[model samples]
Target: MDDKELIHQILQSNNGIIEARQASEAGINNKTLQRLHQSGDLERIEHGIYIDPNYIEDIYYITQLRCKQGIFSHETALYFHELTNRTPFQLQLTIPSGYNTRLIKDKERFRFFYIKKDLFEIGKINMVSPFGNPIRIYDKERTICDVLKKKDQLDADLVSSAIKQYIKEPGNDFSKLLTYAELFKIKDIVRQYLEVII
Candidate 1:
């Protein structure tokens, strides 16, 4: 009925997380948020993000909130899509070329890839983070294409495993995989791997 109740409702609906922008949009001002934070009712996790003290932080979702343009990709996407069993050591995020990644704090926690703006959104999809928060990531086909494109820089076994698992996935779309491979200029390489695996 009031600002505090509205804030609690927002937090409850958003997995106990709330962004200042979201609160503002709900007609609760910054002053109210600050008051709540001062009273220990909310914890400030990032610059403009807050959460209930009892809530476990979803690093993936929090990172996405901090870097709105970032989409989990490469090995991170593979792990999320169940194409790989290995968990990534660092979060892999892709953003449009020329985006200022320097603005992202804790740079060491992530491995960022830059892509042409035109191709940035290709195969982007919503996936639930391990913490059950919604996060943006690349679909399986796009992730396979991306990993193949960077095969030289990634672990050979990891790449091989991901490709093998992807090929065996019942939901995989080979047409989309090849289409994305063509766009990444790795069509021939993709076919070579597919031929070997399939």
Candidate 2:
């Protein structure tokens, strides 16, 4: 297929979104992307990210694309897993301790939690964003452990509610939850909460 046809197919398959890197990997050069943008066939959403003009922007997907190392975590992850009903006022992201936060534009849009590199990938999982784009986030087990670790900075009601909601889910894994708590050195705290709830 021709480059334009390939681009059209990519956009169709990706829910009207495309990335410059993806186009480049598909053998379409930056000049072609620029030409498409100039012709109003594509809209630049962020550096290296583009979308069809009529498409609604997927903020979560775009954020991950811009900050590849950031993983949705804590309350944000809780929301994604339906462990809590409250929407986070500012999206929460977890990044490795040494990651360069300054490189992220609009830093105020996110609340970042930094962890050691070794622990960064623990319980990482992909979930579809509200816009139907796959985004990296912490699994429920890890998210609970993380919030428990940072309970002092969060609302007690929110924490309790999350634990309660998680307990109500049929697929909830106490073993995995405890294991993550142990890894995070919050096993006793997690157990105490579980004891009260269960």
TM-score of model 2 (CA atoms): 0.90
User: Which stretches of candidate 1 lie above 4 Å from their native place?
Assistant: 102-105
Q: Name the lDDT of candidate 2.
A: 0.88
lDDT of each: 0.89, 0.88
In terms of lDDT, the best-performing candidate is: 1
Judged by whole-model lDDT over C-alpha atoms, candidate 1 comes out at 0.89
Over the stretch 118-190, how does candidate 1's per-residue lDDT look in tens digits? 9999999998888888899999999999998898887888989989988887977999988998899999999
* Residue 56 lDDT in candidate 1: 89
lDDT (tens digit, per residue) of candidate 2 on 1-198: 889999999998998888988898999888888899989999987778888988888778878887889999988898898888887777889999989754355655788899999999999998999889999999999999999999898788988898898988897889998989888999999999989888
